[model samples]
Target: MAPGPIRVAETPLVSYLLRRADDALVLGHRLSEWAGRAPTMEEDMALANMGLDLLGQARMLYAHAGEVEGRGRDEDAFAYWRDERGYRNLLLVEQPNGDFAVTIVRQFLYAAYAEPYWRAMMASGDATLAAVGAKAEKEMAYHVRHCAEWVVRLGDGTAESRARAAAALTELWPFTGELFEVDGTDRTLIAAGIAVDPQTLREPWQRTVIQVLAEATLEAPPAGFMRRGGRSGRHSEHLGHLLAEMQHLQRSNPGAAW
Candidate 1:
């Protein structure tokens, strides 16, 4: 006999899916901001493609979450309607894209974590989520490679480039801890085998990051107090501005369609 589908309760499942969608949505927007201003035209295209990929992933997750929540909201509603406090994206993604080095560093850190995360998520009891994870894993592999290449290039480049990369790493490192923090939602999902625990991604992510830093001849910043609370809707000031701009078109003409 064939195995039955792994059933996930609506509440925790919906919340977890929303968090996943929000992370992708926010990061995609951040990457898209580099559309015309990248260091090179080729880089400009690369970032745009990556941004689109993330946005697509977010759309799928949001749609699934909406179905799970039994809400009238669709992907557009979730993406454009929610205020910053209503969003559950990690703080690391909402940080400003400081400069070329900063952007590359952020992408590298996130890709490193996400690649492993999605790989683990492929085994989720939720078949829809598992399928999504399988597809995203392929994209994330490329993302990780692209960002890692940039990190190596910048870190081993001119003195100025190396210093900038280091500075970006220092500024972003503290926020990474929140990526691995487990909360009640994660615990519930983990118990149901419907979600991968973020905590398990940390050590492997660290090893991967450390190896890349070594190859780039860069030093890893000392671990310190990690910021948390993005999962609970407490976001930094930057997210509000991002939301204002992102939701402008939709909010300005409510119910308008292309």
Candidate 2:
């Protein structure tokens, strides 16, 4: 039987879905910032399209979460009404999309996390989540491949490109810990079968990261103290700046429907 949208009953399921969706929303917003700023026209289109895909996925997940919450909130309501402190997205996604190298590194790192997370989630006890996870798996598969190829190409391409990509990867590496950190809510979901423990994907994700870096001729940065706290709604200063730009028009013209 073809899977359908996720249907969740527990609040943890609602919270977890929102967390994943919000993660995508924030990252997609970052990519959208590159619409015309990318190094080349083709890359610009590619980034924009990728942003669109992320946005679409975010909307779908957010809508499903809203239904689970049973609070009559829609996707826009959930997105616009929540404060930054209320958002559960990780700090990694909120990092600014600086250069092409930086963008590729961020995408490569996040895509690795997204792949295994959703793949395991395809079997979520919640029916809708399973379906959403299954479909998202296909889309995210391409994102991983595209980002991986760029990482390899740039890392092995030229002196300048290699340095830049390597630097980007190093800067982005530490934030990755947040992806597989299972907090309290996750414990609840794990017991209930509504969510997969983030730790479960740790090994596979590491293998993916390691293999891709090897192919890219990139060295893994040494383990260092990671800066955490995003899942707690405590974000880096960058999130507020990003929200201001993203919500500028909406806040300025309240309820102004296009």
Best by TM-score: 1
Residue 29 deviation, candidate 1, in Å?
0.3
TM-score of candidate 2 on Cα atoms, chains taken together: 0.93
Question: What do the candidate models score in CA lDDT, each in turn?
Answer: 0.89, 0.84
- Which stretches in model 1 have alpha-carbon errors above 4 Å? 1-10
Candidate 2 lDDT by residue in tens digits, 142-165 = 888989899999988899999999
Listed per candidate, the RMSD to the true structure in angstroms reads 6.4, 5.7
- Per residue, candidate 1 scores C-alpha lDDT tens digits across 51-98 of 998999999998998788775667887787777777889999999999
Supply candidate 2's per-residue lDDT for 21: 89
Best by lDDT: 1
lDDT of candidate 1 vs native?
0.89
